[model samples]
Target: YTFGVGLITYLCSKEIYVMEHEYYSGLSIGIMAIVAVKKLGPVIAKWADGEIDKIEGEWKQGREAELKVLADAIEAEKKEQWRA
Candidate 1:
């Protein structure tokens, strides 16, 4: 998604340069690039962090549930052996 947006912006800037050289000046492009990066950087960071948190929560829950099941099975086996 980022790549696609960057490609389209590049193509658009090239077209703008061909149409009006002054509008595509270095300062203008640099400022625009900085603003876009600043705006997107925090959003991407928050999204990535959220996904990581969700995955970690799921892993912890899964491990606890698995351990509980194993412990129950062991207890049942021990009870059965004692009764025999």
Candidate 2:
């Protein structure tokens, strides 16, 4: 949008100059940019949180697998000791 604005500004420089720059184009652009950011912020945050949750779930699964392996080893050791 900024690029498009720059392009329009470049193309209409003479017309804008003739208008004596009375139009609050800069202010309007700023307001629109702010509105866009406000609207997108929550969506971006939600996407980031979803990604973090996926990574956290993978880590949890890995930890659980490691714990199970250790538990099985300990059980086998206990049985060996009993046999001895």
Candidate 3:
């Protein structure tokens, strides 16, 4: 959606300059760029937050599984030592 707006702005600006005498001033163009980035900032932040959540969840599950494996190995070792 943001890309579409930026593309349209760029195309329109080029067409206007070539076909007509109209031109976008540097300040106006800079403002448009800033607006686009600001508008998309929230969406990008949400995506990043979701990604971090998924990674943290996976890390937690992996740690639990590893701890269980270690516990089982230790129990087996203790039983073997007792039998010996």
> Could you tally the backbone clashes for each prediction?
0, 0, 0
Best by TM-score: 3
- Write candidate 2's Cα lDDT for 16-81 as tens digits: 544434457876888999998899989999999999999999999999999999999999999999
Model 3: per-residue Cα lDDT over 1-84, one tens digit each: 999999888977877525332345766788998998899989999999999999999999999999999999999999999999
TM-score of each: 0.56, 0.59, 0.62
Pairs that collide in candidate 1 are none
For each candidate in the order shown, give its overall lDDT on alpha carbons.
Answer: 0.90, 0.88, 0.88
Candidate 3 C-alpha RMSD relative to the actual structure: 10.9
Model 2 spans with C-alpha error above 4 angstroms: 1-33
Which pairs in model 2 have colliding backbones?
none
Off by over 4 Å in 1: 1-33
Clashes of 3: 0
User: What 10-residue stretch in candidate 2 is worst by lDDT?
Assistant: 14-23
The best candidate by lDDT is 1
What's the distance in Å from true for residue 47, model 2?
A: 0.6
How much is the lDDT of residue 53 in candidate 2? 100
Query: Which residue pairs does candidate 3 place in steric collision?
Result: none
